[model samples]
Target: MKYIVFFIGLTVVLLFFFSSCSDSNSDHENKTEPGIQHESMKAKTVGIDFAGHDFFQPVSNSISHIHGIGYPNNQEALFIATHHGLKVYSNGIWYETKEHNHDYMGFQATSEGFYSSGHPEEGSTLLNPLGLLKSEDFGKTIEKVSFYGESDFHHMSASYYTPSIYVVNTVPNSKLGTGLYYSLDGGEVWMQSELEGLPQASAHSLATHPRLAKIVGISTPEGLFLSHNNGNTFSLISEERSIGTFFIKDESILYVTADGEESLLEQSLESDDTKQIPLPTLSEGDSILYLAVNPLHEQEISFGTVAGDVWRTEDYGDSWSNILEKGNVP
Candidate 1:
């Protein structure tokens, strides 16, 4: 009787997992409503959200100048944000979206779609400087948030599941002045953070909690600091010299530093514990520039390098697979 009951329980659990997975994939599709971008009394975007086609062509020379990297809500594939546009990697293959190539900068992926700032392509009806745009269909249908043509945020970090936004503004613009700014109401309103506990050195990079609206991080040449109060203040997390690049995955902050030998470390948010993930020997003059964690599969992580190299590890950094070499498809 015990054995039979155990078997029955296991079967039920497996069924529930499969059912949830099926629902997960369709939820984003059903919830995605087409969006429009309006600027100067003109339609900024008129592209179809889904082309009604499920086909993609293999692409090459699509990985250089990578600004950021991400995975869609479903974690079906990894998307590379580049100066030319967005390229995708899945099942050991690289593909590109036709006619949607735009200079994507400060890209942040979310549970629904993705957010970015950059310039639109030639045929794009949207404003030249994609001040801030949200794609409900992964860059097909874009919705204007703010700063339509005023600013192209180069350093931005936003919540993966919330409307919170934080950016390190390097230039002053109409909607924002140069400094650290954040918005909790989905870009409806904004506020500036005082950066109380951050080191005096220049902030090199930024990261934010995936679900928590207030949790954020900043890395400098001196150290890494995290803020629970939305950048109003911060607490020192690591003093390792940052190369101005890092990312957040769930409850941990993963960062890299150039201390003699380059290294990547994951630090727990709940404690001071830190452990290093194996490093793939990088060529001289190259450093990890961007990172993305598969939300659904935490063990799977990927990163892009300054030299346009990309690598993935499905077993939580135990091993790595080089997907792109110097921005080429091979």
Candidate 2:
């Protein structure tokens, strides 16, 4: 009787587990709501409410420049990297991570986890300039992969096609010989990348192609540069837009934002024609700070501004939905 009871209980638990997983998986797909807190925009949680979860609240009312934006492996939430820490928006709610309040400079979200290079939070003895740090458990804890105390990468990016990582090492690591470091083995090993024809080694922003690891697009003070032979050589693509920052959503499409420009330029690698689309001006003199495209949903794109305002467009820039604004937390 005891054995039969145990078997029955186990079977019931398994059935419940499977049922819950199936329901959860379907929930995200069925969610038709476009933006966060679509029904109630004025709802605000009380002070310091988030705990025992992967969420926190930004202490400041306004936000700094959004360094990076990405969705994790599950694509259930969008992660925003600001000067404060990692902020996640999911299921019509805004959540912030309490752990590791470091200023992530070179932030990138991958299916594996979050990778960054930045300064450590106050009261922590980790390092002033953290190089190649990763957090697999959603910004709860970060571990150093390489160049812990020696270097900082202001512009760093990882490729989705292959295990390739690139960074413009601002601080030279004596062992690594800095300028541009490339890691083919997922940050396990690093070496100096060949930047033969590039006018400027420093980059304001850099992006690796989604389909080819060899292809890279860099934005500098001079202009935008494209590399086809895996950073061995680079050719100047355009100097007309005064490209301040750029990101490659895929092998063909490169989204760019120029300095002091209000329009977002969507440039195609296959064609010389580019579309200059104006972003929604949430506040006065608002320009796009960073842009990110969902790997799972290629058409879905998200961009934020220095004023802590975020917007999303799901239909290839046909329309947009405001996610959140400064001083307003959902």
Candidate 3:
């Protein structure tokens, strides 16, 4: 009887110990294991959390990471490139693209269509890293123009005068990866430019003159450089001003934003004078990350923020309206 009682007690103790161990293991798995959540997140339009949000009608996640912005011709919409996919805000209605939610790295919507390069979406059998892609129907379908698996452009700009012309900063391990590349007949043919006379050795952003065929402005780490004779050579315009992005508003004025400045600076190309355009109503801690001025209407401009917000000004930053709030992308 003593032996039987002792064995029963030992069995109970062992059972209790195993049960506690199992519960601990289960808890750890629940905390660390990604399971379906990780896989679901890979899809741009899957498993999204859209709760208690008044602005977001069909979006699952908040717009946090904005890469680029484009305004295609004949469309009354603004295509915004985000981490998830391309979003369109048209006619006061916000919509997220349904298919081909690939990551668009360098996006520019010209009169022709949308041009970009980046990685493809999850579960896609297409090229992992999309080289140069062109979408004629806005940001709906992408077709390989050139560099199918060769390069990914992070900084791309199109000439306003010529729709097929583009200037891009190429990725490494590609054919045109040495320096600045300029394409007159689209991405079909590329010419590696020497970018002579630039004081700074490196290039950041680039913009072509709206009317001039060969004139282009390049933003470097040091300052802004202007190339009057195509891209064969350049001349430093401003030494003290650190240019982040610049847009050629006609041939007389250049809209510029510095590295850490809040207000927009309008620099006269003829007089070489600078003036500040104030954005007084911007939310606290929100600064301009990107600027887009309408080619047809210079006064109508939109600026995007690093915090996923967008503001528009019809009078060139004098008065502003927050189109997309800081956390609400509608």
Candidate 4:
């Protein structure tokens, strides 16, 4: 009976040793072989807002310039332009489109569709011309339409009253004719507006008044231009100061950012007169890259800077608060 028990114990030890050796060999093979199992690449989280605090999230890979950002008219989706392609954030999911070789310039949304434009990319060559794209499903997809050859597009504005109509400004390029183009048929075709009173400088931003369909404002390198004839003609409001980003609350009030100043201007659209309103002070410069006014409250406004700081104003630009701090998001 003792001999039988010893033989069984010896058999069990040999079996255990062989199984351990086999498992070790399998792990070693996976480490050495290219097709064997391996850890997956980590995903990138570029930016995050936690409990109202902004944080910088890093990406494992580099990306192209973020030329533009747009939000849908009726949805919470945000569209970002990256060197890789257009990135859409919707319902907590991020999706990237195939690279189209274009530098996304500007974006606008309407009830009928969404509009965007950029410089075209072909192979290794990049064309500074305007290429318009449209999407009906809140940027779930994009389709190229008319190509304004060689002219660089700097600004775009969608008509609030007429959803199917939009306008874009082209910088003077050697290859492409520089000016503005109006698309009345939802980007299927475009016609140049020969507005006699339009300014000659490049238009950088455009906005239409919410209540007045004929009242529009264009921010150019020279100054601000007003159009009362539905973009058919334009006239300079004030040429003494260079206007950067601008927002129109109504036909009576206009908010504009002036060059070389940290304060924003509250001007009357009726008289083109201005009053400088100081913005919130920051350790970094007070330069603002973009300004957005609350759709419901004209007194509430948000301004973003190149240093990644976002400032909010609640009392009609009289006082401001920094909502986002610099170096908090990358």
Candidate 5:
């Protein structure tokens, strides 16, 4: 598998995209008060604000195992989920968490905070395969949603405005089947999609509409497929083989594709109109892995590559500034 897990650092894409014009569907909200079986959480030795501002010493080593990226704190900070913990990039400086370093898999970032699933670090007492969880106060605390100690949803997506969740289960578990399943009422009930028009080939990437309930974009070796009826059926929208896909707007999407040369494109969902965006050149064999479009400012875009390189374009890709170079703190 080329792109193994979402690690959604965005929509956690917020996997590459996710908000809304309607009332939010986020019913399974976590709280600081004792409510949702947070028996395993232990006070960390480190103080709050792990490697946050006032401690802007640049990391000298290479940053690896980046799960994904997102625009948290209302597009003011960029949070990078990794195998170790969460890394923050703000004001052109990078920082790391002091204690909370759980390998955040299936990470999705929203305006409020983020939703993620993964396992605890080596000595941590949290569940081995942490179930779906959410955090509103940065990485300071977390709230359990569902499937605690039962599942680690690496392939997942959630609507930005509502609590609609989707995942492609790898195996049959006590609560879900081995296929694509989504829940509208939090995680209480899950519905498996028919995926009627999806290609027989394996899906490479997935994206969900930030607002729309039943819209999903599945990328395959064949092309990109759009399902409007909650994966009940699909239609091929693009023929170009894409590596990563992210929804930038309700009717437009940003994606990465490489043939002889790498390319970034923003295509309209309703038609074939696509405008190519300029991307900083990548090293050989390194391509973009994830994208995060600012929900507040659609003109601004950022992306990370397999080599741990992060870049941002403030003028709609007309120009770009390198935030991280091959995971190196520049």
Candidate 6:
């Protein structure tokens, strides 16, 4: 009888231990990490058709993990941020900025000059100190601005109508404060803006309408924020979602992309109203990274993804056509 009881007790203990282990593993899979979420992502072959012009015909040299994209005024040049430095595409020619070895994180161009921000070096100085570079002759050369010191910049946007004013988002270190900084004299000087009503979140994207200088939008990890008084104050516009890109066609219409999702959101900037526009769905393994909209036409926009997918939308975000597939145009 003693042997029988002991055997039964051992069986019960083994069953309980296995059940607890299985439950723990299940919980671990369901939990999400900070600043990251799990979702169904895919990569697909695509092309970009813009106003009867196909931009995917030209074979690209290499897609160097683009960090930002901009088109300057009075020139048919496309500026792209790369890990090595800034790359410029003008009149079917490509040029790279010299003497800068930092990773270009964001870019903003104006009639007088262009601005880019990134880390001075990778790894040890990512948050402690960051660098901002400026160029005048279309990425031929660059100069470092002396206003802000050692601040990690995440995103930057220049005013198209008002080129003198620019905004940058920085991650404050334990020694330096974190917030939005505005430059008025073409990045010659910078001042910390008052972010009273905006969420205390790091910014991922910054965009300013061509017509509305006072209205500016920012994409942050927490959500989206908009400022009407030129960064004096801000208001929360979207809930907690990772915003990768933001574009404002007019004073009333806005578009944004959420991280880990292929769907684009079209919202009314005048009020608290929004509508989701369907985009060309990515394959089962792709994820979008950034998006850009043409200033001349509200209906035309472009987006880049992790799968090296470049897509363009002629009818806004209602429909999309692929421009380049993975490894098609680097």
lDDT of 4 at 38: 29
The lDDT leader among the candidates is 1
**lDDT score of residue 237 within candidate 3:** 75
Off by over 4 Å in 2: 1-65, 201-203, 257-260
Q: Least accurate stretch of 10 residues (summed lDDT) in model 2?
A: 1-10
Cα lDDT of candidate 1 equals: 0.69
Note each model's CA RMSD in angstroms. 15.1, 18.1, 18.8, 23.5, 8.1, 17.0
Model 3 agreement with the true structure over 1-330: per-residue lDDT tens digits: 000000011011111110011010011111211110111111122222323222234555566567677565524456678666777665555667666777776677665566787766777765545667776655544566666555656666676547444445423344454455667776667776666676534444567776664777776566777877667788877655556666765655444445564446777677677778777556666655566776555677776776668877778767877778874854
Error of 1 at 259 (Å): 2.4
Among residues 3 or more apart in sequence or in different chains, the pairs in candidate 1 whose N, CA or C atoms overlap within 3 Å are: 44-126
Q: What is the C-alpha lDDT of each candidate?
A: 0.69, 0.61, 0.58, 0.49, 0.68, 0.52
Candidates 1 and 5 compared by lDDT, better number: 1
Off by over 4 Å in 3: 1-60, 164-174, 201-203, 281-285
> How far off is residue 187 in model 4, in Å?
2.1
Q: Can you give the TM-score per candidate against the true fold? A: 0.82, 0.75, 0.75, 0.59, 0.82, 0.64
Candidate 4's residue-wise lDDT over 225-328, tens digit each? 78776667778887545666676665554545455644577777768677877677766454565565544345666655555455667687678766445523
Residue 148 in candidate 6, Cα distance off native in Å: 9.1
lDDT of 2: 0.61
How well does candidate 2 score on lDDT at residue 262?
A: 50
Report the lDDT tens digits of candidate 6 across residue range 106-191. Answer: 56655445667655434332221334556555443445453223443445677765644554433333222444566666555566
Clash pairs, model 2 backbone: 55-96, 56-96
lDDT for 191 (candidate 4): 56
